[model samples]
Target: MADQGVRTDRLGLLLEQFDQAREMAQVRLTGLGDEEYLWEPVADCWSLRRRGEAVTPRAYGPGEWVLDKGAPDIPASEYAEVARQAAGGMPVSKIAEDWSVSVERVGEVLAFTGTPEPDRTPVTTIAWRLAHLHSCFAGQWEWTFGERRRDPRLLVDFTPRAGLALEAFWATIDRWREDVASVTDEQLDTVGFSQYPYGSDPDDPFIAVVAGSGLEFIHHMAEIALLRDLWRARFPGRG
Candidate 1:
């Protein structure tokens, strides 16, 4: 009942934005310094902590879990504190560098056309990001197809081909664009399944998930780009 031509038009604009953000992220990361990959644009951001750094337990609500904690119903101060605590002082540069290292591994595995290796530690490495992309894609697909009973699952490949970091990130963006492209007005308003189970309401509807995911992608890309910029500034000749 919420479907309308106006809604479709708005979604089209948002989809274009998603593509641009993805592209910009790749552009920013290219030719960045190896050390720059560990730059933190601000304090309390997530980064690769050295060995012995304290690790806090991630908090999640009871019941289902989503990819990210949804908008906090609590006051802004508490929300910011939680996010700050979650970041734990890791730099954006570290995240990019870690991701780049994983890309190198992906390139080798794919180049040799070798068999996929088992995930010894699934969530700890860049493998998590790759698997996250796949899961997000699968979840979006299930939601679009109206299959609410299925749950999104993540699988990791140890040996990845080169350029995979960009490929995986960009591929998800492309899929989202495609999904939104064919989305009818009626479907836009339909409730969809999200990996973020504890954060979302079952009756909330699909449009929210699609838009929220797009926004999440954009935010991540922006962070990546900022890291790249910081790296370039820190080491002027590297790029």
Candidate 2:
């Protein structure tokens, strides 16, 4: 009975964390406009783009819009090495020979894959960040409650407009909350309760996944809020 009480308390705390994060996110997102949503504070920032405008090797979602996301299996380390070599004025052919990949492949990596270097990481637009946050919640929910599917490409809703995107994100959050609300204490204690493939969810206790999800939400929402403040600072009197 005590164990059951502890589990219930833990679940309740996780749910409350989600509720607080969602409320704060909604407040931060209030009155956001397309211009602010898509604003590029720095050049060549990752953002939501029209279907044909994406420069990434792989983009996601259906409809006329896409997020500038990379393939899940992208060799980020190899791309980072290629980027480092290229930055140091090494010829692509030399880098390719050292890495045993084609010169064209090296060029493709440089063009399509992002560098892991702190200075080279592209600033992401609000739209990109929000889309990422939405995808995280939606993907976990699908794998945890709806289906065991691991493919995020199947989950659409990369809306281009800010208002529509927020609506879609809110809907996802609502669905996730509803699903998680029904999770039993036994489920919380069960390892592999969440089969979310993108992360270590399959090996983690459902309670841990819930806690991690809350942390993810809080950090990303704080980032979005900071970006909003920066935007306001950059362009006085403009949202």
Candidate 3:
């Protein structure tokens, strides 16, 4: 059983931080113009190229062979299976790499309004990244919210890309913010609220997971902001 006062305090703090993080992302992205979205501060940094076309230099990590720039909104399990079957033994590190790449691509797409090419070799594009992010978020949320517990290894399939990539990205963050904000003290201390199987305590309270996600949101928001600034500097006047 959880202590009521403590749980309330923690829940309040988590919700506050979640709101702040979303607000920050909104502020950073709101004024961004098209040209500034793809500015690379330095060489070797990847940008979103024409859709279907792969960004140069950076290779698609292990199991990301086929890239679908279209929005399928497929279930997370199916998406994970595809990656597993296609990208044999895709390591966990590759997931992190893809995350970084996706962040960069989204920055590019937001900064510039270019007609991405279709009907080409599917490369990891911004749309793909957004789909992946959404799946991961939904997976995590399912653990924390629905089952209120976690699997040993949370299996999430990252989609190649979806049509509503940008819209979904924004919606995802928004949903996270709302969900976090809605968590009450009762929810926080409820064991099995977080189904993070990797955690030492799978039955840990939801508050802990919310706390971690809040931290992650802040980190990613900063990354997005930095990318936006880089794009702004590179593009100057073009929107």
lDDT for model 1 comes to 0.46
Q: Residue 156, candidate 2: how far off, in angstroms?
A: 2.3
Cα lDDT of model 3 by residue, 1-239, tens digit: 25554344667767766777777766766755433443445544443444345544432322333223332222332334334422555443433243333434333433434443443333232333333445556657666555644431233332333233445666766766677677777877777666644331244567766777667667655766666665556666655
Worst 10 residues of 3 by lDDT: 66-75
- Residue 44 CA displacement from its true place in model 2, Å: 1.8
Scored by CA lDDT, what does every candidate get? 0.46, 0.80, 0.50
What is residue 100's positional error in candidate 2, in angstroms?
A: 20
Per-candidate Cα RMSD to the true structure, in Å, reads 16.7, 8.9, 14.1
Ten residues in a row with the worst lDDT in model 1?
A: 61-70
Clashing pairs in 2: none
Candidate structures ordered by lDDT, highest first: 2, 3, 1
Best by lDDT: 2
Which parts of model 3 are misplaced by more than 4 Å?
A: 1-8, 31-135, 146-163, 196-203
Compose the digit string of candidate 1's lDDT tens values, residues 1-239: 23653334666766766667766766665654434433445444333333233132331212232122122222322333333422665343332232333434333332443343443321222222333454665555554544554544431121133255346555655765776677776766765333343234233466676677777676655545555555557667774
- Pairwise TM-score winner, candidates 1 and 3: 1
